[model samples]
Target chain A: MKAIYKREVQSYFNSMIGWMFTAALTAFIGIYFMAYNLFQGDAYFSTALGATLFVLMVLVPILTMRSMAEERRSRTDQLLLTAPASVTAVVMGKYLAMLTVLACPLAIACLCPLIIHFNGTAFLLSDYASILAFFLLGAAEIAVGLLISALTESQVLSAVGTFGLLLVLYLWDGLVAYLPSTAGGSLAGLLVILALVCFLVNALSSNWKVTAAVFVAGAAAIIGGYIAASDRFAGLLPDMLGRFSLLGAFDSFSVDHVFDVRGILLYLSLIALLVFLTVQVVQKRRWN
Target chain B: MIEVKNLVKRYGNHCAVDHLSFTVEDGQVFGLLGPNGAGKSTTMNIMTGYLAATEGDVLIQGHNILEEPEAARKCVGYLPEIPPLYPDMTVLEYLRFCAELKKLPAERRKEDLDEVLSLTHLNGQAERLIRNLSKGYRQRVGLAQAILGFPPIIILDEPTVGLDPKQVVEIRSLIRHLAKEHTVLLSSHILSEIRAMCDHVLILRKGKVMACDTPEALEEKLSAGGALELSVRGSAEAVRSTVLTVDGITSCEAQQEGDTVKMMISADGDAREALFYAFAQARQPILEMRPKTATLEEVFLDLTDEDDAVAAQAAALLADTPDEAAVQTTDAEQEGTGDESDL
Candidate 1:
């Protein structure tokens, strides 16, 4: 695992991807910092970080588009898979390598809070905490990119797919607000979601019996709950999805000026789930 | 030692490997001989744990590849059909990374790296990026990667597929050198290469094992002492009578020419001498006569061809000889035991 991690990290720098990613990210952060803090009188580095969050939707894919996709394209995955390393180890090695690349700009950004303190009155505690939150958010996005890369062989497709998904996530909060709020409407929305989950299960497992069972159980549970207390279903669709807003969690530190432990845990859990899915994708290719 | 048992791999509905089974003995060079799409690469991939078999198991040095992967993988080194390499790294960096991945002892990695570099003749190109190296050099780098830890078993899928003749010979000799201490299993569609380098060859066709034996046995068993093509300057009756007098002639078919007779004659053994004397005594001048011994090429074509009758005949002959050949191999191994220990 260490060998793979070292090689992946070295490979990132050996090519132009690592240096370009770091420079582009840092440049974008600098632009935001100048606009919000350096030029304006605002002393909170966290505001600059908040303005820069949108930059990740474009940059995270650059760091991760080639992570697993290039290995498949070049057939180097053969060397990794046939080695003594497990699938989890290989995926973790790659994920951590991308995290290490994402860290470079963050490490440079780490000085911004200090610069703010030297310049004038600064919210040092809140600013450093926001940087940590920003790092986790980027790390979570990188994990999502890695999984998309694992799904395909073409790096272009991987990058586009990741960018598309991240764009959706960037608009997640606005999208959730458009969901139905009435009891019958939310119940209908939940049924459609249940059907989509059943379809996903069928595609993944290729077992109609299990998918059917899940659909039946989910429909029964949703309908049973709606019938027992119709009030509970009102606005339930948006309320549930609102909890999953990745940016919402990060906004607590930068916008609300408070440490949101649940948000941190959500980012960590998303990273773990995406990494596991990438491993499963790689392992499934062997059998197919 | 490596064992593949009742292996079957299916891609959708097409069977890539079907009920294929073979045991590669320790310290021997085993060859998987097959034409394209014959599942040679797929079988190698399964044996090395790169791909999972639809059914059956691969055991490497007594450890099941699926159940005890790390233990089994530690004992074997594999080079897939295409040499899997990262083009961005220099040759030395790539090999050192491979050495670490194979988990060679940290203390001995430098020594092992140097030895493998020299063995594959990549020392001068060590600092060059793999992207700049030629195909042959890249192949050598892949070979060096596989040989990094000196695992007990080495599996190579078509190690000489794209090389020039000189590179092929060098790679063959390198494989031979590796066979002294490590058991090597390599696949090749080229008949002569396998015959020259392997102790045992398993021929595959349509995902089935067609024949498994030594090269000499495969050639000798399928061809019944060979055949003689004769053109005699005489009437068909006279030529036929004269050829019938040969002692060991098994079957003869004659074709009439303007003033000569052409005959294809199979024999139990060499009957050229008897035929010559019989034609001389009969006064039927022999216009042309040439003995045709079946080469491995012919046997390979017959075994892999879609013609069921001829292929079945060759397969039957192969099946009949392995029992005898098995005993002979043990005897040969017993004789070579002294040399084996010296390695």
Candidate 2:
């Protein structure tokens, strides 16, 4: 794991991706910092960070585009896979290396809050906590990019796919808002979501029995609950999906100044899930 | 020691390796000889723990590859068909990373690294990025990577594919040198290359083992399907009729040139003594008689070619040889036991 981590980190710098990512992100964040805090005289540095989230949606993919995809494209994964290292170690080493690259700008961003404190009244604790949330948000997106990279051998496709998913994540709240709000509409929406979940389960485990059971059970519960208390079903689907908005979790930190412990847990769980999925994807490739 | 037991790898509906099995003993160089798309690379990949076998096990030093991958992989170093190299890294950096990835002890890391660098003759290119190195140099870097830490088993898939003749010889010599200390298994489509390097060769055709034995043994079996050419001063019909009387002579073709008849005889076994007396009795002057032996190249082509009738006939004739017949009986016994275990 250490060997992979060291090699990945070195490769990142040896090429232009690391420097380009750092410079691009820091430049965007600096513009936001200058516009919000310096020109607008804002006291809370989190507002500047909130505006820079879009910048991450674009730049994080570039930082992680080549992580696993390039290794597979060039057949370098053969070396890593045939070594004594386990798949988990190989994936973690790469994840941590990308995290290290993401940390570079964040490390520089750490000084932004300090600068604000020197200029005027600064919410140091809130700003630092928001910075932590911002870093976790980037880490989670990096995980998403890593998984996308593992899914394909084309680096361009990985970057584009990751950017598309991150775009959807950024607009997640708006997308959920479009969900049906009436009781009947919510019931139908829940059934569709359940079918999608069952499809995922079927694709992953390839066991029709389990997938059928889950689908039947979920449909029965949704219909029965709707019939029992129709009012409880109103606006449930949107509300459920709205809770999963990744940017919403970040808003709790950068916009509302709340620690949002659940939000932190959400990012942590997403990272873990994506990393596990990446490992499984790589393992499945070997079998294929 | 490396033992591949009934290994099978299928890509969707296409079976790449079909019930293939072989074992490499300690301190020997084993070769997998096959044409392109014969599952040579796939088998090596499975043996090195890169690809999971569809329906078999690979044991490296008694460690099952799928069940105990790390233990099994630790014992073998594999150079895949394409040497897995990182272009961004210098040769030295890449090799060092491999040494660390192989989990060499810290105390032995530097010593082993130096030794591998010198062994592959990568000392001059150590500081150069792999991106700038030529194909042969990159191959050396890969060879050095595999030879690092001196694992007991090293598996190379087409190690000399892209090398020049001089570099091919050098790499072949390097492989030979490594075999002095490590058990080496390499695959190639080049017949002479295998003949030159392998102590034992496994010929594969369409994912199945066509034959597995020492190179000389394989050639000797084909040689048993012997043919002979004779020049005699006689009519074509007379020479043909006399040669036909010999025991074990399958066919005799005679062509008359002026007063001399040239006859080519295909036989199941040695028919020289029988033909000599028959010609003498017929009062035909025998000017020349030469026995034709099959070379290894002919053996390879005959065994791997789609036409199996000729190979089967040769094998049947080989079964008549007393010493070779004993080996076949034992092989049959081993197959019987293998079937019993499957049951």
Candidate 3:
């Protein structure tokens, strides 16, 4: 695991991808720092951190698109897999290498708050918390990119798929508002979502008996809950899912200046889940 | 030592390897010989713990490859069909990384890398990126990696496919050298290499083990000693009748060669003395007569067909002699163990 990690990190920085990724993020964040704090004389460093979140969605896929996909394409995965290393160790080693690459620009991001202190009065405590949140968010995003990269052989497909998913995540709040708001519409939407979930479960497990049971049980639960408390159904669809939204949770530090532990839990779990899924994808490929 | 028992691999409905079983004794050069798309690589993969066997198990040095892959793999080194190399790294760096991955002691890594490089003749190319090396050099680098850790068993799948003739000889010689200490199981579709290098050859066709034995034993077992050539000066019928009088001689036919009669005898044994005495007594001056035995090429052709039933029939066609005498029959008549057809 250490060997793979060292080799992956060295190769990333040895090529143009590492420098290019760091430079692109630094340049974008610096531009935002200038616009949000320096030129405008704003005291909060977190606003600029908020502006950089959108940029991370595009830049992350570039940095991580080739992580696992290139190994599959080059057939180098054979060496690592056939070695004594377990699949989890190999996946985590590469993931940590990507996170290490991400850490460089983030180390630069840490200086923005200090620069604010020199120029004017700075909200140092909130600023540092927001930076921690920003780094965690970026780590979560990179994990998502790594998982997508592992699922596909084509780098182009991995990059495009990650970018598409991240774009939706960035617009997750706005997209939720567009969902049906009326009680009947919300109930119908709930059923459709459950059906889609059941469909995905069926596709993954390929077990029709369990899928049908879940399909029936899920329909009963949704209908039973709606009838017991009609008001709970009102706008509850968007609100429940919205609470789990990753980009929306960043709004606590960026928009409201509140540290949400619940949001942090959501991001960490999602990151762990995606990393596990990446390992599963790689394992499934060996069998197939 | 590696023991593979009743190994079966099927892709959907088509069986790729069909209940094949063989054992590799320690310190022997075992070759899996077959044509294109034969299960030589598949068998190697299963033995190396690369691919899981569908219906059977591989035990490497007493550890089941699937149940105890790490323990089993610890005793084996594998070079796959293609060298799984990182093109971006220099040869030395790539090998160092492989050494570390193989869990070699850090204190010994540098020495081990140097040893592997020297063994594969990659010392001069150590500083070069793997992408820039020639085909033979890249193959050597791959073999160098396989030889790392110095495991007890080494499995190489087509280790010399992309190499030139000279490099092929070098690799074959290296395989021979390794066989002195480690159990080496290598595969090749090239028959001559297997014949020249291997102590035991497992001939596979359509995922089945056709025959497995020493190269000498296989050729002799399929001896077709009925056909012979004779030289005599007489009428064709005169020579044929003289040759037919010999005991154990089945049939005789003669063709003319200038002033001499060229006779081919279908005999159960060496009819040299019988033909000579018979021709002299019949007033037909005799010359040369020799029985023909099947070559390795014929043995290969007659043993391993893509369709098992066809190969079984071809094998039966050549197995006229009883089992015990057959192996010695070709050896006694053909003095050299080397191919008789070439002679």
Candidate 4:
């Protein structure tokens, strides 16, 4: 694992991707910090983090585009797979290496709060906490990019696909706001989401019985609940999806001045889930 | 030692390896000889724990490849058809990375890396990026990677495919050198290459083992009904009539090649003496006499009922000493069993 991590880190530094990512991320964050705190005389540095969230949609994919896709394209994954190392070790090693590369810029951003404090009144703890959340958020997105990169051998396609998904995530709240709020519409939306989940479950476990059971149970529950209490279902889905807006969870740290434990857990779990999918994606390639 | 038992690898409905079973002893250059599209690479992949077998198991040094792959892989180093190289890395970094991937101890990694660099003749180009190296150099780097740590078994798939003649010879000699200390299973489509290097050859066609034995034994089997080419200085009609009139002669064909008659003659018994007597009676000078030898193509054809069956049969039309073998029955039996399935 350490061997893979060392190689991945070295590879990042050897090429331009590492420097490009750092330069782009630091420049963007620096510009935002200057404009927001310096010109606007913003008291809270967390506002700069809130502004910088938009930059992650582009920067994270560039940082992670070649992580697994290039290995598959060049057939070097065969070398890694045929080695004595386990798949988990390989995944974690690469993921940690990407995280470390992501860290170089995040490390530079740590000084932003000190700079703001010198210039004016800066809430250091809130600012640092938001930075922590921002870093964890980037970690989660890097994992997502890793999984996306593993799904295809074309680095360009991987980058484009990850960029698309991150864009959707950025526009997540507005996307959910457009959801229909009628009980029937919500019911239909719930059923569609349940059906998609069942599809995923079926694809993964190859067990039709459990998938069918979930679909049946979910249908019965949704219909029964809707029929019993129509008012309770109104506007429920959009509200729930808005709560699930991954970046929306971070709103408390930046906008509400609250350390969101649930948000941190969500980011960590998402990271775990993405890493697991990356492993599955890699294993599936061998089978094919 | 490695044992592959009843290995079957199928892609959906297409079976690449029907049921390949073979064994390599502690020290031997075992060759998997086959044509293109044969299952040699698939079998090698399964044996080295790269591809999982569809219906069988590979045991490397008593460890099952499927169940205990890391343990099994520990005993083997594989060079796939295309050497998996990192183009961005320098040769030195690539070697160092491979050494680390093998979990070679830090204390010994420098020495081991140096050893492989020397063995593969990669010393001069050690610091060059792999992308800039020539194809032959890339192949040698791959060979060095596979031979690292001195694993007990090294499986190379077409190791000499892109090499020049000199590099092929060097790699062959290096493989032979590896055979002294480790088991080697190398696959190739070239008959003479296998015939020259392999201690034992496993001939495969359409995933079936057609024949496996030492080259000498294979030659001796196809050499049973020997045919002789005789160039006699006489009229074609007269020479043919005299050869036909011999008592033990089974069949004969005579053709004139520039004032000399070339007669392909076969007899029911050792008829060289009978033909000589007949020729002596006719007073025709037997200018040149040479026995025809069967190459491996004839051997493969004779076994597989392939395209060369007619040619082999026409060549083998000479009847006489049906059992003029080059070895004893036990020698053939030992060699045949060594190649049969999982010896």
lDDT of 1 by residue, B53-138 (tens): 99999999999998999999999888988899998999989988998888899999999999999999888999999999999998
The DockQ score of candidate 1 comes to: 0.79
lDDT of 4 by residue, A1-288 (tens): 988999999998999988888898899888988998888889887888899888888888988888999987887877888888888899999999999988898899899899888887779999889988998999988998999898888999999999999888888998998999987788889999999989977866668999999999999999999999989888988977887678887888999989999999989999999899788777655444
| Model 1 lDDT per residue over A119-210, tens place | 88989999999999999999999999999999999999999999999999999999999988999999999999999999978866778999
Model 1 stretches with alpha carbons more than 4 Å out: B229-264, B267-292, B307-310, B317-343
Candidate 2 docking DockQ:
0.82
Model 1 C-alpha RMSD vs. true structure (Å) is: 6.8
For residues B1-343, write the lDDT of model 3, one tens digit per residue.
8899999988778888999998999999999987777788878777776677789889989999888777887787888888899988999889999998889888988888888888888888999999898889988988998899898998898888979999999999898888888989989887888887889998887887777889987777665555677788877766666676789986666687778887656666666776677777888876766656566666675455444555665555444454443444443333323322321
Please state the CAPRI-style docking class of candidate 2. high
Sort all candidates by lDDT, best to worst. Answer: 1, 2, 4, 3
User: Which stretches in model 3 have alpha-carbon errors above 4 Å?
Assistant: A182-231, B229-242, B253-264, B276-291, B306-309, B315-343
lDDT of 4 by residue, B207-257 (tens): 877767777767666563546789999889999998888787766788988
Q: What's each prediction's TM-score?
A: 0.91, 0.89, 0.90, 0.90
Off by over 4 Å in 4: A206-232, B273-288, B301-343
Residue B147's lDDT in candidate 3: 90
State which candidate, 1 or 3, has the greater lDDT: 1
Per model, the share of native interface contacts recovered reads 0.86, 0.92, 0.47, 0.56
